[model samples]
Target: MKPGLFVAGFILLFGHCTSSLVPKKLTDADGLVIRTGTSAGMCVGYCVFDYVLNGTNLTLTQRPNSVQSNLTTKTCQSTISQSDLNDLLGTVDLATFFKQPAVLGCPDCADGGAEYVELQLGEQKHRVTFQYGQTIPGSEALVDKLRTHRVALNECK
Candidate 1:
C-alpha cells in the first residue's frame, strides 16, 4: 500500500472510534431566559432581554432602559422548529452548570451591560448574574454563546 493510502486508511478506521470514547453531553430541560442590562448615560439606562421556548413557540423580548422617559417595551415572538430547539439543547449542559456566580463583575465601569442568565432542564434550574464585560469562570464559553444568541435574537427588533 502507498504511504498516503496507508495513513488515510488508518485514520478512517480509528477516527470513528474516538467519538465513543468521548463523554456524553449533559442534557437538560427546554427553557432559557437571558436578561441583559446596560448602563451608560442617564439617557440609556438598561436593556433587558428574554427568550422562552415552549414546544414550537419561541418568545423574545427586548426592553431598553426607560431613560427615554418613555414607558414602552418591545417584544417579538416566533415559532421555532423542533430541530432548531434540539440544536439549542445540544449547545450547553444545563446540569452541573450555572452553579457559581460570575467573577469580577459589578465594577464601577461606565457604559457596560449586565447579564442575568437562567436555564431550566426538567426539574433543574440555575440562575446567575454578571456584567457582560467581566469574566465568568467555568462558563466563559456558555456566556459567549449567549452573547451571540442575544445578537441573533435582537433581530426581532
Candidate 2:
C-alpha cells in the first residue's frame, strides 16, 4: 500500500475507535417534564396559555388580558394516556433537540405571536422559543405532537 493510503486508513480507524468515548444523552421518562405555551402581545380572551406535562398528568393554565376586570386566569386539569405519553417521548431526538439554540426566529414581534417548548429530563433543562406558527427544523416531530396536545387541551372546556 502507498504511504499516504496507509496513513489515511490508520487515522480513519483511530477516529472510529475513539468515537464511542463521547457521552450521549438518554431519554428517560421518569421525572421528565414537557411544557408548551403560546402568547400574543396584542390580543383578547385567553391570549396566553401554559401547558405542563408530568408523567400522564397534563395541566393547563390560561391567562387573559390582566387589565380587563372580567377576565380571570383559569386552570384546568387533564390526563394523557401512558401510550400517548410514550408516543410523545418517542418523537424526541435528543441529539438534535439538545443542540438547538434557546431561541429561534423573532418571537412575539409585531404582535404576531410567540410559542415555546421546554423539556426537563432529570437535571437537564432545555427550552426553545420560536415564531408563533413556525416549527423548529430538527424538532418537528416533537413539536407536532405537542401542538396536537395543546389543541386537545384547548378543547377541554
Candidate 3:
C-alpha cells in the first residue's frame, strides 16, 4: 500500500473514532430557554434558562427578588406577587419554541430570530423565545440549565 494512502486512511479512522466518542448531551430535554445579554465588542453576557418539568405542571413560589447594592456587596430583597411567580414557572414544547418570531437585535448572533420554548406552568403558559441560529449553542446550554433546575425541584418534592 502507498504511504500517502495509509496516512489518509489512518486520519479518516481517527477522525471517525474521535467524533463517535464525543457524548451527545442534548437529548435530555424536550426544549430549552436561551437568554443572551446585549453584547459590546469582545465583552458578552449570556445566561441559560430552563423549564422545570414537573409532570405536566410547574410550581411557582413567591421568593424575594434581589438587587446588588453598591454600598455593600450584598443583595436587597423585594417582594413579588403570586401571579408574577406563577407566570415565571411555565413550560412548553420544543417545536413551538422554534416556531416563534425572534426578538429584534439579539446579542448572540447564534440566536437570530429563532423561536423559543413555550412552557405551561401552573395555570398559565409562558412563551420562552430565543434568537435565531442560537438553537445549537444557547439552546443546548439552556437545556442543561433547565435539567439542573428540574433535578433540584424534584429533590424538593
- Measured by TM-score, the strongest candidate is 2
Write down the lDDT of every candidate, Cα atoms only: 0.55, 0.82, 0.37
- lDDT of candidate 3 at residue 2, scale 0 to 100: 100
Ranking by TM-score: 2, 1, 3
Backbone clashes, candidate 1:
2
User: How does model 3 score by TM-score?
Assistant: 0.22
Give per-model TM-scores: 0.57, 0.77, 0.22
Which model, 1 or 3, shows the larger TM-score? 1
Where model 2 places Cα greater than 4 Å from the true spot, the runs are 1-29, 65-69
Residue pairs whose backbone atoms clash in candidate 1: 29-121, 29-122
Clashes of each: 2, 0, 18
Error of 2 at 77 (Å): 0.9
Ranked by lDDT, top first:
2, 1, 3
Which tens-of-lDDT digit does each residue in 1-157 have in candidate 3?
6999999999999989655433233222323222222122222222222233333344422211133122222222223343433333233233444444544345345433233444432233445444533443334544444444443443211
- 33-129, model 1: which lDDT tens digit per residue? 3333333332353355666655446567656565564646667877656665556556655443545754356632454655556665445456666
